[model samples]
Target: MLRMLPFLIVLALWIWAFIDCLTTPEEEVRHLPKVVWVIIILLFGEVLLGPIAWLVAGKQRAVRGPRQTPWAAGDTGNGGYERPRGRQLAPDDDPEFLASLKKDNKQHEDMLKQWEADLRRREEELRGKDDPDAGRRG
Candidate 1:
């Protein structure tokens, strides 16, 4: 087992480099094309050169800030979930969506009221024709 440690470390580094190269975006690859970097890593992985080269200079790695969770902005009164910055809100959570729904509902109600009025007018005309005395009685 002791004799295998160095080999295992190199193997692990090779595998890590291969995966990192594959997962790196094409636009983010530096100094060489992404495919070339992949091939280099695979070809010289056992010798530690390719993996080291890739890790040191093959990719343009961004210095990322601390990650923010959905609840990082506090409860927001929305089941403890807050919309991430620059992300779209769900329809149910969007004020604009609710406003549009209310506007549609008002339009529908107005249309329904107009239809009911028209129907009542038509019924009154039909009743007058059936019995000319109907309006006189009312």
Candidate 2:
């Protein structure tokens, strides 16, 4: 196991370099085209030359400070920064959606009131027809 450590380390480095080369954006790659870097890494990986070259000169790696919000990344339309990962609001939690729902509820309530008033008026008319002398008695 101890003897295999060096080989394992080399293998891991080769794999990491290959993946990094492939995943790194085309614009970020420096000194050579991204495709060339990939070919180099694959071709010279056994000797540790390609991986080392890639790590040293393949891409422009930004120095990270504390975790930054996407806005703080200072994206200047160059696709060089991360975007915000804001969570979506639920419908009930959305103020505009809730306001619309309240407006619909108010309209329905108004219609219900009108229907109730019309029903009462119809009932009164029916009673008047049933007892033509009701108003005369009063």
Candidate 3:
């Protein structure tokens, strides 16, 4: 039972990954070809290929319109953020607003990195706990 447990768990994970890959759109999956993804699903199995696909070849690039920054939302961390009282804001040269926008973007990037690191830590912990000889190699 103990020996078979790992195999069963791995098989389950492979099936789940394969299903997920099948559902993901070809356009959204990057790096590898769509056929390669299928082969990964079929050949390497989920436990290995899922993470590989995600890390090395995932998430198609997208073009987007102008971003909405905190500056655009009328929030600068400074004591007072001034929007044009009369007709309109000048097209450019708003230092305070631009600075705030840059700060917001940096913070968001930092948070995303932290989240990825946290998730990686959790996965490593789970894998470590599952190590077969951790209890006693003797």
Candidate 4:
């Protein structure tokens, strides 16, 4: 047991550093991938470089958006900013307004799906073009 003291000290140091890394907010935390973060921390020691990682790693939310202008175009009826239907619907609400929301949501979802599919297809094409015989078994 006495011979393991050095190893235990190393383990304690690692635990302390890792906790410091996690306690930090995600946004403030460095955006680099895990592998990169590991390399940086390991290459740099606690006395000299440990503070760098502690300084990073925290959530950084975007600034609040500007308030919407009531007079904005398309927001009101008769060429003014008009609230879209269903925004203030009662329990017994307008079917047409609900339909509009459903349509808009469906369109958005469809577009997102299409974009994801296109990305996958492009990636596959790139792999195939880069090494035409990459998958061949010899």
lDDT of 1 by residue, 1-138 (tens): 999999999999999999999998899999999989999999999899999999999989889999855464445645755445687889999998899999999999999999999999999889899998887898
Candidate order (lDDT): 1, 2, 3, 4
lDDT of 1 at 82: 48
lDDT of each: 0.90, 0.89, 0.71, 0.63
Q: Per-residue lDDT for 20-82 in model 3, tens only?
A: 667788778777776677777678774566635644565454679788654556565345755
Models ranked on TM-score: 2, 1, 3, 4
TM-score, prediction 1: 0.49
TM-score of 4: 0.32
- Which candidate, 1 or 2, has the higher TM-score? 2
Return the lDDT, model 4, position 23.
60
Q: Hey, what RMSD does candidate 2 come out at? A: 14.1
Scored against the true structure, residue 123 in model 3 reaches a CA lDDT of 89
- What lDDT does model 2 reach? 0.89
Best by lDDT: 1
How far out, in Å, is residue 3 in model 2? 1.5
